[model samples]
Target: MTDVTSAPRELRKGANVAIRDLGGELGGLTVFLDSRGHDGETIDADVSVLLLDASGKVRSSADFVFYNQPIALNGAVHLRDKLVPEPDSDEAAAGWSSDVVTLELDDVPQEIERIVVAASLDASTARTFGDAAGVRLRLQRSSDAADLLVFDIDDATTESALVFGEFYRRDEDWKIRAVGRGYQAGLAALVTEHGVDVSEEADEPEGPEAPAVDETPDEAPAPPGDAEQAPAPPMPAEVDDDTGTSSPATPAKRSVSVRRPTRAPRLPVDWNASIPADDGNDWQAARLFPVAGIGSGEEQERRATSALLAVMSMVREFGAALTGRCGAPRGTITTYIEVPFGQDEEAYRPDGVIQVRRGTREWTALVEVKTSTGRLNVEQIEKYVEIARARGYDAVITISNELAGGDADHPVAVDRRKLRKVSLHHLSWDQIRAEAVLAARHRGVSDATQAKVLEEFIRYMSHARSGMGGLGDMGPSWVKLRDAVKSKTARASDKATGEISARFDELIQHLGHHMTGLLGVEVQSLAPREAPDHASRRQQLADSGLMFGRLKVPGAVDVLVVGADLRADKASAAITIGAPRGDTRPLTRVNWLLRQLPDEAKDSIRIEAHMAGPRAVSTAALLGKARQDPSCLVPEEQREIKAFTISLEVPLGNKRAAGTGTLIGSVKGATTTFYADVVQHLRPWVAKVGSPSRAE
Candidate 1:
């Protein structure tokens, strides 16, 4: 204890730091750096923790002292490095991430297990995060098909990755080679600059000696060349996922109904027919160009232009909107698009071209968007009037400025009115979900309260006005709703004190096992009761003959947990375990009326178990007489008064956090307002009582 090992230090450089590895074997080093003090506001320059060896020099140093302070990342917002793994069991309807979805191309999907797609629009730009528009689809399997793992697309942008339905741009006219005969013979020796060879079936072996996925210690090559990274077999394969939608031969209805994946399988043939389909009038302007309600396609305007390219990619202002019913695409002309039958390409990305410019004149506004509702035969509007008459353009439709002009008074003004793209809308779906909740709270991404004003719904289209800004109208997106409101305002500003000490120790062992089976003994101690000491209860009731009488019953038990010192503790008395079942309709016949008796009794005596367990009385109170009742609980036992839960353990250094969030609620009639984002684990107070009140 007298030798602290010869110490001394000195060193300096451009240095820059911030650390706190406490608990790392006795928590030493606590330095802090990045100068600029005295009100200039930036401090921390302690540095010392050296100790390098293998030829790097320095072997003994110690000065660092973490707990270091000084913070400010400007307006602060870096929600990255979330270390994935937060999908908590299908998450409330596809939350937490299924690559933020939206695909409904034409309805008919449900057999999922592996079906993530986005060969276009930015390799599925995280499907525009947040309310993943009717979510469901999820897929994750690959040794290295260019490992995005499942979306990381360079900090993920381009409007959050085109809502991830599909994207893969590189076809300089098509020449990546290798078209058919599928694959397997070692993926035909592997290759792809565009030769995009895809055999997909290997790595199958799932049982016996299931060990050879790859160990090598001898052979290795695959790195960024992920032609679908290989791991196991390559033969015995079986993939069945399903989802569907397609009808324009004569039956149009649908307004809002989702859930698809009824049949997407069959790949090996041109993999996915070279991704095309947009002709049913360019999927009615790509999924209804959202601003209110109605459709066209391009995935209903890919969630407000990936939510306005995550805020200000330039400028946007759609009013009244209302889409679907069909046709309304205007101005810039030049059509000729056609993706029939197999449409739902992740829910209809129509792309028939709709450039709407005039935000200040490059003037070019164009058109072609389409729709019919659902089943539209007659060759789906005759292949959209022969792809807008072989790419000529000039079919002005686009209705809803609130349906253009009915009652003959120009609805919400779109200039004179009378437009025609026709398939169904004149303005409905509750006025486009009421202007998409006032445009998702005027774009700050909702939170105006009154319970989020129906999340400001917006989508009812009719376009064909282009000056270059109709790349399928990418308008409002909110970076996963501002990262789900800054992860719910940093989980409501932290501190639940380990969820209130594990919900007060699981509600005191769930109401202390029904109060130790109604006092038949065996409770040892529950502690924490305080707030009562009238001279230590009159000096333990002046040496108990066992009668300090303080009877106040209307559902007794209020802080009288005499568990251990019952006069020298006869193993903790209060052992009258039996017969006590009352209250069938008391409390002034349910309105819970308690007007008298509680003026602070001196020796305590406020009786009323219907004035002694009702004995056979028959009703008569508040307005005169006194007793009348006989139902002391026994109608098939009676129970309903227990709820409170919380359980925390979160250390989150990654290892895929299996615990940590603890908090509980659902308790009634006393006090409750939890919801700091609904984390859970507390348990105490679990009443399912009903009748058994006197049990041991």
Candidate 2:
């Protein structure tokens, strides 16, 4: 392995470098397109990959992987979900949004000569790469998540599509080149150039149409001999359809049928069966992995490790979902508990070992487990990395209760030098449980027994005795910081204040992760647009006596804003949506929103109408009051309505624990209640077809 401590080589436009030159071998590599814009501008772009043959063209449509086709080549090339950094983390502070594409180089087919990584603006958004700042690509060795190369594209102008780089075959070796080329014609044209059949009619209904048939032949069919002697029906006369002029006939081209891969139907799980029935009996069903007698942290760790590993080995879908996130190729997975290893006369037994075998290749990782409130030890992790490196393992994975803030960074910082050959990764118990729920309940497990086993594992992990709790405490500084903030004496630079802020961010992240599992959709934590960095957010909290975070739930009308107001002793969740454009009367617009809410919402929700004009003030009214008059929320001056904000507030909890009357509980409860009662029911206003716009 090359010296990983060396600084990543920065490539200029059109520069080429070999993969071996940077990482010493061609293995699992990840391409990250980290994009940001100045002045809080959002760069809406999509990253895609094209696998090409020696002709520099895709072999088939299946070779293209993008938002629509996220995985291709049997998991050799996969476009991962967009990852947003925690609002207060360094990545978020720098305004970077990451889109990742993983490449299992060894798994790439022998016929594939090149892998191209490209990015393009979303067709719905009329924006170009020039609008973005610090648009760059980082190539990281997936095994260690270490950056080997970085390329910055500084000259993108009027271009909607860009080819950041490509990995191509070089004799018996693979090499990468920085190809910072741009296309103003956007994704379709760029992909077409690479031999993807760009079908504008792809969105149209599928299935073959019946051919027009003539029941009566125009004439008696010719005899077989006559037919054989007949010249092919005279070629249709060639003419310029646009100019009505004769033109030369051209040879017909062979049409290539590129069929999009069909996605398998997701089977539904019997969630009701998974839930235990309370019949007031002392008898309970026997579980595959029981969590009954866990008394110490060690016991909890052992049971959790054994149960999770065993399940991962049995359930194919669940295991792939988890291992794929750690950069392992799709393969047959085998997991073992308490794997023993020795290095330099020192013996070490990692909690588990995960080995994934694909064809002749095998990828292995050492796992360290921590249950309850056990924190990862820095020296312990460094030692494991050393052992993994000596043993030629690919990665060292740590599973614990501690939540990683941004970029899946480890809670404990280990020496960077030890991670050159072996990568280090962290997984929170909350994340593991969430993934399990998604796989078994949402994504579906094909085998009935495997699904049952996964469900059992989930039940065992959910048990309080298992000690795999999710985001339970706000840390020891919660009380003092809460008091100081309430009293208006918390300094921005105070150690306690920083701790509280960091923990609060973690709470918000965990909330999003939890919602993802429940809703079967990815929910993300976002920084308030006004405060882009942690320092500014801390200052904002110190000045306003409030901490604010936002959640971006897919398909929601708007990002949900959550606020914890220390001064007011309230926790609130709110969302703002634009008013219907065609409605002429304020009453109609007000009723438009009112009609979407359930009748019970009138009791606890508040509505605010934001009026147009620079100096216009928004009108506020409780939903119950607004239900009666509607005019209560309308401005007396009759300023045109611009938008409306619906919000719910609950008394903030003061304690630091997980259950009722605790700060974590209150925040989570408030967000969940707001979503269930309000956000879920509200739809974004869309202009109705054929509806006339009324003049103000």
The numbered model that scores best in TM-score is 2
Worst 10 residues of 2 by lDDT: 208-217
Model 2 agreement with the true structure over 135-254: per-residue lDDT tens digits: 999888775567888889998877778888888777678887777777776776677666676654432142221111111212212222211121222344577889986533322222
Against the true structure, candidate 1 has what lDDT? 0.21
lDDT of each: 0.21, 0.75
Evaluate candidate 1 by giving its C-alpha RMSD to the native, one decimal. Answer: 32.5
Clashing pairs in 2: 144-423
251-312, model 1: which lDDT tens digit per residue?
22221111011111111223114337656663333322334452445444344333322221
Best by lDDT: 2
After superposing candidate 2 on the true structure, give the runs of residues whose Cα lies further than 4 Å from its correct spot.
Answer: 1-277, 405-408, 527-532, 539-545, 582-585, 689-696
